[model samples]
Target chain A: MKRGSLYTLAYAAVLGLVCALTLSAVDGFTATRKAANARAEEVRNILTVLGVPVDADAAPQELLRVFEDNVTEEERGTRTFYSYEHSAKGFLRAVRFGGPGLWGRVEGFLCFEEDMRTISAVTFYRQEETPGLGGEISSSAFTDQFEGLSAVGPDGSPGIRVVGDGADDINEVDAISGATMTSDKVEDMLNRTLEEMIGRDGFDG
Target chain B: MARADKQACATCGKGVCDGKGVVTFKDGVWHINPVAVQVLGICSALAVTNRLENSLVMGAALIFVTVGSNLFVSLLRNITPRRIRMIAEVAIIATFVIVFDQVLKAYYWEMSKQLGPYVGLIITNCIVMGRAEAFALSNRPMVSMVDGLANGLGYAAVLAIIGFFRELIGTGGLFGHQLLSEAWYTPNQLAVLAPGAFIALGFLIAIFNAISGANREEGSQR
Candidate 1:
């Protein structure tokens, strides 16, 4: 065999073999941790945006306290909330949140009570916005405003739609001040999520 | 001295035809500058430049990717054929990108998420390929090694300067913390956007070109 031919064959095989091995190893190393981190971040986002008291890097327990209503996912699309059992106690409901974004999309979940009225926990799935300005929608000041508010709209519909408030009232969100589009998008997204999850009729509660 | 010269002659071609370091230097400084010259890897610079702290982390990642790929390509240059060099180059680059990506996740998860797709995009960065083909392929290992270092350092300096301005103006902060006093003027939101990267880079390139051009003229006259 020619020297060049032998070198080329061996090198290609070795490179290919090494790449395959590295790909598997990288997947193994990152996939599990990445998934867990993603879940935790989602939980944190929901908690933060809903005005729930959970740190951005808070553990699952911090979120669990508020999200005590474990609503398991319905197989036949019966219930909107995902329910799960707690420490040998009762169940809890994790309400799903979704909305259009200025650029792409934003989604999240907030677990609440059986009445589907009071806030439980909040998290965002996706948000493509300017980091500090629009992205601050994830801040507690914004979500904390949602806490203790009626889950139904002004029309008494399920899932309240956020409208811009002229005053800096604590109960009403101020519409992200300069970021009107982002604010509106999130508001509409919340309204749409409520409409889809619940119903056109007012909250049965 | 006598034995060294004899060994050089008998070798397949490392010492005989290797580039005398100039090609690698040019690759680092002129042809494939990480910022202005080649315009490669600008996404990370834009995304992370919001803070000097994040930019430093990003720059370090860039350096590691460039150096890791450069070393591997040079080491395997003996076996890499001319026909499929590009294939080998991309594979080597991707391998290093994964390594850096994993490292970032393990330690700096927040910064890693902020950096997002830039780490994965390192595989497509032209600086790595440009240096690998132009210098690493034609040189000894040490020369190629130095080439990667110089490029990385140069790239980092550019990132730091941009980050300095963007962070100060955009957020009145450094590394995501407030640096300016409360009395400072309002932050310039424009500097934080993607378009700001283009504007800042344009001015930087023009200034860089002007300064280098003046130096050349002075040297010639002298």
Candidate 2:
């Protein structure tokens, strides 16, 4: 009813309207580009793990080109995975898999050698872990250790182990020092998620 | 030199060419630099300074938010009710922050992802709020915009220097390229973590203080 209160309410309403409009316009303009970049990044990550050696500075179109030319999607029962084969090199298979991370779904691709028992590379495309701590799991420092490591043990058990301090086994990678939960989650995912995928449809190496 | 006249210029009307506005604008950025001097938003400074790409992107985002919010706040300063001014300022700042976030997500998705929550956390950065209240609310639009930009650069400068050291020494790389040969050099892992950031920042602040102090002596004479 008061004059000043009416002005304040009108002011708030107008400000809110303008903000909504601005944000919507920005969102509209950016949505497609964001999706495209995300797709390119996914392709790039897969290409990297496949030993295809994607240049980080390569254009999005170039990355897509490589992906289209080199990668083929295959189905095993209900599961789908990517396989890369070259005339010089034998065959490399990659699976895009993840489970719950410390904060949210951590999604990434893991590529294996033709033998299917050794991990050739592991790359995380998305993770919601604490920065500089658990988040380091995606860094090459951590993922590089997975390369050339056995994902399955000699006696047919979960072979990948995450050591909290230091690791001395071929199948072990040192965990991030300050990120115990995230490291543990990664260890669990490696052991469980990979096995679940393998059992779900009996993936043929 | 004129004390009485200086006080009068402080209350000059908007759209006026008063030296007070200019001086305060400069002061907000320099003599009272947000990061080095005032130490307002050090959280992002440390977190993002581990790499040059991240620090640059974060700095640009902060500049965009600060300048955008300052301009908007100055434009609406006359109409914004006193009782709810803080709320209005926050809403305006958040809007710009989201715009920055969306732009990064669209164009620089990798950098955007690396920066992560820090981009969204700009709304909570004290420097933005500090400038909005201390400078923008009571100044002309142009002055407020300049003030915001200068302060953003001040913060950026510190972040970049800290980033340079962290990236160079911690990773033996600059912006992810290995600068030091592995055979001849090894990285200081401590510089890759938060404690390293604190140590780097402390030394930087001390160095900046000494340099600025010397500069002030010459500045006063001129």
Using TM-score, give the best candidate's number: 2
TM-score of chain A of 1: 0.64
Best by lDDT: 2
lDDT of 2 by residue, B1-222 (tens): 235534766765434535455676567566888998888899999888989878888888889888889988987877788878999999999999999999989888778888889999999999999889988898767778888888888888788889999989899999789999998989997897889999999998888777776234454642
Go through the candidates in order and give each one's C-alpha lDDT.
Answer: 0.68, 0.84
lDDT of 1 by residue, B18-40 (tens): 44456656656655566766566
Number of the top DockQ candidate? 2
Q: In model 2, which regions exceed 4 Å deviation?
A: A1-3, A75-78, A86-89, A101-105, A113-118, A128-136, A139-151, A157-183, A202-205, B1-17, B176-186, B210-222
Instruction: Report residue B195 deviation for candidate 2 (angstroms).
Output: 1.3
Name the Cα RMSD for model 1: 5.9
lDDT of 2 by residue, A55-149 (tens): 77898889999899889988765556788984444688888778899999898888877777778888888797997789999898999998788
Worst 10 residues of 1 chain A by lDDT: A83-92
| Residue A82, candidate 2: C-alpha displacement in angstroms | 1.3
CA error at residue A126 for candidate 2, angstroms: 3.2
Predictions: Cα RMSD each: 5.9, 5.3
DockQ of 1: 0.39
